[model samples]
Target: MLVRTGGPLAAVDPSEFTRTMARVPTPVTVVTTVDAAGRPWGFTASSFSSLSMDPPLVLVCPAKTASCHPAFVAADRFLVNVLSATQSDIAGRFARSGQDKFGDGDMVPSEEGLPGLAGAVARIACTLREVLDGGDHSILVGHVTSASVSGLDPLVYHDRRFTRPEPTPSLTTAG
Candidate 1:
């Protein structure tokens, strides 16, 4: 447990803080976009979440240092591909720097012209709704124009490794 003393939070080193934060499990997702020349580009991200239901907004954060960051920022639209446990390899491919991540035979084009990875649990197509200029990373808020789900289990990340969730109560209970 993380115990908090009465005084100011003890100064922890950056590596320690990063490793500590990595302990929190996060759902894996692939953020895909088109570059200036209309070529496909994308990267894997764990920083994604639904923001609003009525407006159907979603959020994703891409690191400033990411090679595909410019492509995503420049694109008018993008797709958030939620990967399943079987897609850990896909996520790893996109996470690498300076490589033709999509060269693998797993990605396909979506109806909306964005690249969609095969066997993804869910794909959310969105237009760039907003961009918040955060330090070291940019927070992208998207308006979900279209979406689809495969109804499969989602892949997860924790402590710099891939993980899968244990079976839980289903939305439809046994009758």
Candidate 2:
């Protein structure tokens, strides 16, 4: 048996930890919402995951320095657009700063009026549930109001690059 101590888990350097974890693959997504002034705002993020299925909650962590951070924090409502493999360009567009991210995209509105990319693998509309204060970023938890899924492969992020899921071989028997 190995012994383990429970005292804040040995303060590992954050930069090193982040860089190390970035090596772990994650799914890429575009979180979108409208600001109080009704302008579309969005960001490409991989720090997103499903928190709960019962109450339908999801989490998206936007860095403090993100361009759309302010608008997202204020609106408290948003949509998680699960990008398809071919949507890597769109994700990159949103990730860039100093320009209107929604300018050259075909964004349509969800039932809640949040912007949803035309063809994502999945789109989840959510209302602000809670915002937890994290050191470098705020963990925004949203209660999913509605969700939709279109049949498509998801775009993934790994090794500091975008990736696509490879098709699996069918298990059908050939006589």
Candidate 3:
């Protein structure tokens, strides 16, 4: 049975919308960039995706209030470090507001000259392409210049919790 009773669909409640979106799984990554003074800045982001292949483009969303937002917006290059399932602590450290996120000293200079986490599942170095307004966050598009990936599972976020994806079973045939 179906019923139609409204001229337009009602707007979704913000909290309910958030709750619904939380069920969708996303990869956790740390977006890093160096400031003009040569200081490293970074933040954890679950909103990242590949947009193009011919141009090798990717995008990440950083909130306006993020501590490293200004630096990332002004920088010419940045690195997206795809976290491994074992790196939840690193993700938590970068997610905080006013703390020494890099104080633990597990970073090395990436090929792009930005700080990269030591044990990431993958690293993508990119040059800034564009910045677009995205309400409370900014959409940053980058042209990937260099990238590397390790044979490891990535960290994931779903329902406001950290989780790891299960590997699919391989097909085998008995001779």
Candidate 4:
């Protein structure tokens, strides 16, 4: 049996870890929320996924060093916009720091009053459930309150590039 300890795990180079993980395809998203003063804040993230169904939960990880981290940490609610295949520009812009992220992404106010990408393939508006500490990011667990889907192709990130999935022909047996 393997041993479990309270000590830190073996170290691995962050660059290598990132490069390895980049091989996996992930949906690109821009998570948005409002600050205490009602100012909009958001960040692009690929580390998001559905966590549960019974209570309808989703989680997104925002880097702790991100400029918008504090605002998200303090937000009571937030919106997660799953970018459409054509919205790679929005993903690129939101990933940077100290730039106009919402300038040309066709962002509009969501019904919940949060900044929302109008071209999202899906939109999930959630109430803050909990925030847990991940290695270099905060894992924000959200309780989904409302959601919408457009049935559009989603922007996918793979091998450090943005791409979309191409549908494969299905095989069916004739009766």
Candidate 5:
């Protein structure tokens, strides 16, 4: 229950906040970047969205505690790969900490050398633009350099699980 005493709203419990957030379906993405030594780093992220169109920008939040966070924070560019529902296993691998994330996946390197998933439904190559504070996570803003879509249904996360997005049939006009 939330009670407003005429001042500020009561602080919501973190667990409750998490539960409430789970109700919103979000696309599953694997954001990848490399270290100074050229070692690849990646992680599964559901906290992602397009932020702008004119200048082309996107945002993704990676927890500060993520093992690959440092690599991303240091890299000047990264790739955002929206996975197809069939890649749930790949998403699971990236979501885990201290595991080999790219070993079995269809990892491919772009012309500019950024690592990305081969069969991603959508891939956005971005130049790291800005970083903002987001409490436990860091909000990374990227300037889109190039983007491509595979015309496939994307995987999504909801209620703490990954599921295929069922496409709704488009209606025809009664012409």
Candidate 6:
């Protein structure tokens, strides 16, 4: 069944929009960069995706109100550490504000001199390419300089909870 209202689209309720988006599954990642004083700053983000392959570009959205937003926007380089299923704790820690999120011993300095998590499923070192306005968030476009991946299941977020993908079942043919 379809209902036709020919005028204009109505604005969605913010709570409803958030609840709806919460149902969508997204990979968890911790985006990290070094501050001017060489201190590490990080925040958990799910709004990350590969934008292009020709120049090897990726984008991550950080809210304008985030405490580390200024550091990220001013940084020349950053690293995106794609969390593994075992990294839910790391995700939660970074998701919070006004704390030393890197107190845990899970981080190491990457070749690019940025913070990289040890058990991440993937790590992408990138140089800041562009910053675009995305409503209340900033779209950070990064030109990947180096990247690596591990054969681990990615941490996923859906319905406002952390989850992992179920393994696919094997199929057998009947003779």
Cα RMSD, each candidate: 4.9, 3.7, 4.7, 2.7, 3.8, 4.3
Candidate 1, 18-117: lDDT as tens digits: 9898999999999999876878888899999999999999999999898788877877899999999999989999899888888886889894888897
lDDT-superior candidate, 3 or 5 = 3
Range of the 10 consecutive residues with the lowest summed lDDT in candidate 1: 3-12
User: Can you write out model 6's per-residue Cα lDDT over 70-93, one digit (the tens) per residue?
Assistant: 999999999999999999999999
Residues 1-175, candidate 3, lDDT per residue (tens digit)? 8988869888899999999999999999999999999999999999999999999999999999987899989989999999999999999999998999889988888868889977999999999999999989999999999999998889999999999998889989988
TM-score of each: 0.87, 0.88, 0.91, 0.90, 0.91, 0.90
**Which residue pairs in candidate 2 collide?**
none
Judge candidate 5 at residue 124 and give its lDDT.
93
In the range 31-115, model 5's lDDT, one tens digit per residue, is: 9998899899999999999999989999999999998889888889999999998999989999999778878848988735888
Q: Each candidate: what lDDT?
A: 0.90, 0.89, 0.94, 0.93, 0.91, 0.95
Model 2 misses residue 121 by how many Å? 0.5
Tens-digit lDDT track of model 2 for 1-175: 9987776666889899879987998889999988888888999999999999899999999999987889888876899999999999999998899987877756887759888887899998899999888788989999999989999999999878999877899889889
Better of 2 and 5 by lDDT: 5
Candidate 1 segments exceeding 4 Å error: 1-13, 169-175
Clashes of 6: 0
Residue pairs with backbone atoms closer than 3 Å in model 1 (clashes): none
User: Judged by lDDT against the true structure, how good is candidate 6?
Assistant: 0.95
